[model samples]
Target: MQIRPCADAFYASELEPWSEYISGQQGKDPGYDVLGWMIEETHKRGMEFHAWMNPYRISNSATAFATSGAANHPAKLHPEWTMKYDNLLIYRPALPEVKQHLLNVVDDLISKYDVDGIHFDDYFYPYPKGGVEIDDAADYAKYGAGYSNVGDFRRAQVDEVIEKIHNLLVAKKPGIVFSISPYGVWRNKASDPVAGSDSNSLQNYDDLYADVRKWCQNGWIDLVVPQLYASTSNVNMNFTKMCTWWNANSFEAKLAIGHALYRFGVPAEGAPYQTLDQLSDQFRISRSNKNTCGSFLFNATCFNENKINILSRLAQVYADKALIPVIGKESEAAPAKAGDIAVEGRTIAWKEQPGMRYAVYTVKPSSVEGKWDAKLTAVLAEPSWLAPGAGNYAVSVLNRDNAESELSQPVKVD
Candidate 1:
């Protein structure tokens, strides 16, 4: 649940001065080493960490420009390689070199750190504005043979990068999950009869060239968290209706609704800030969907403000207990064995070794057969006590962050 700022581009820009300055003041940058530290810290606090990375976007506003250095900046260094359509900045994804470079960045992160997953948000190709077009003519001319038009070329470009990234990630680290948060609107009903959403706004497929449907069908990503950040009555994009639409369309991968808790209680003209009731309604809808895994609130910082008492209510609902979001079934690895189990009166304890977490199970005697029934009692970051009068029990050690682990040999108690 970490809100990652753009740091890889900061390093690529050779703005070591700014990078060093920020790292020195903050004690660490959000690069591989820093992210690794954060993962360990979050795990210590009984939470899982996902490394969020934006794929094709280099920078957005002037603020990013100001923080960046001149000579080494991405736009400056690769002027011809950038697309400045509608004043939004985007790297030319059609270029093989650009795709390779982005892959290299991901490769470095995956190889170096033990991150749970690689995350990409809704900025696929810059949202098309007015009549302004994404300038990829030069790239298309250079690499666009066989494709009929620029649109097809652009779509193919995104597809190629996504497929390559997915394949490489699984190959390098089969246990790590790959996820994307594409723009909620896959397409309008007019465009595709089976489209999940009906927004008049820019579609991930039509405008951004992100062919999200194809990605889902191909199973390139482990999860698809669409950003359904609109109110219920907004005729163009009703949140609840869209959530159901997405769940219906998702192709076997985990589907988690990106809850817009940030918009809760914020004032706006016409579409005023949503009330707590509206937020609750969205949660209920998500829960009702059988295919839906769970929910992740956008931007963790939003919860800190306690706006409209949402955090208090959320904490009440999810106190003490933490949920380990289900990783891809294929990502599960062999379980690790529990070691050095010890007892002190009513409390039993054991070491949660590196790469393994603890799951305490209680055993009950079978009425009919010699076999005993084992039930998972708790999945925790640390060891804990068992109830008194336990007949037989075993502790299963799991990967802590993921549910992949082997059960420890059953211990007997009289």
Candidate 2:
């Protein structure tokens, strides 16, 4: 599960430190941190927590929000660093201050929370509106060093941000994955010599100024989840065709398909997410490819609402709980073997290994040795794990990259 901590002004958040710019000062805090609660809850369910954001966007509409202190907002403080386009206030990527502010927000997240990954979707430059000009002439003139054209310069700014963030993640926390889910089509075949996809729609490079292909080629991110929100049958943005393209192109990052679960049973002009089966088919198609790591649903609320029986269809696909796919540099290390396993009452403990996490598994006492259908009880940072019940328990060492070592001998407890 992922929480949009630093989203547009609509969400009342405590994701960032509560000073003057957060919801806390405005009396919007619900007596708890939303991101903290989400992280704990998601971990309890044995799922990874990804902190997500739509960078550059401060607001989605024209209505001026009443912040606790408008002067405290970076948008208000540095008005020149932002642009008003499509009725939204967006931070200009070219500005050094704007890029630094975003980097600081990410730094705050990593320092404060224990998120498995950081996510950014395609919200770089606003979806274009005809005749709506973004006046970044001063920024372009000052900062456009290597690029001749403004378009290329804008793309470079976004690229720099991605590279900087990747560097920060590697330096501060190497295990934490950095991912971007850019718009599905990176570039059409007509646009670039290396572009392979045939879909002729809003390209990430041309329209949004997001050079996704460059990021992948340069190893700037750990995962690239292209928002393949189209139906497999849609001619413009075919899901199957795009998945094939992404898998072939994923250089250093793992490819995870972002399925548009929210669109299930929704109407459209030429293509509709007609049924739950459409999403199921997308899942199956993603799994069929060797490069495909996993998929992420658009929003978690859909499962809660059980929109158009999607939860049930998902249940069929996810019959068993699975570990998050290890990626990036972390996946290369195999953790050392677990040692000195012991159990007393309802507690299980093992000798600690350097830079390793412990995965505790439990099976029935009477279960056959070879037929040991062990279920993962807990993955703890510490060597000790609380025994779930009266079952035989085994422990293994999981390394920084999530690689698990061979299981130690099982200890039976009454």
Tell me how many clashing residue pairs each candidate has: 2, 1
lDDT, each prediction:
0.69, 0.77
Best by TM-score: 2
What tens digits encode model 1's per-residue C-alpha lDDT throughout 243-334?
A: 88888878857898887778876776235344666766777788799888878787776767877788766765455444365666455555
Question: Residue by residue across 185-262, what tens digits does model 2's lDDT show?
Answer: 998887876765978788999889998988999999989999998888988888899999999988888899898877
Q: How well does candidate 2 score on lDDT at residue 346?
A: 85
Q: Which stretches of candidate 2 lie over 4 Å from their true place?
A: 1-34, 40-46, 66-69, 267-272, 331-334, 342-394, 410-414
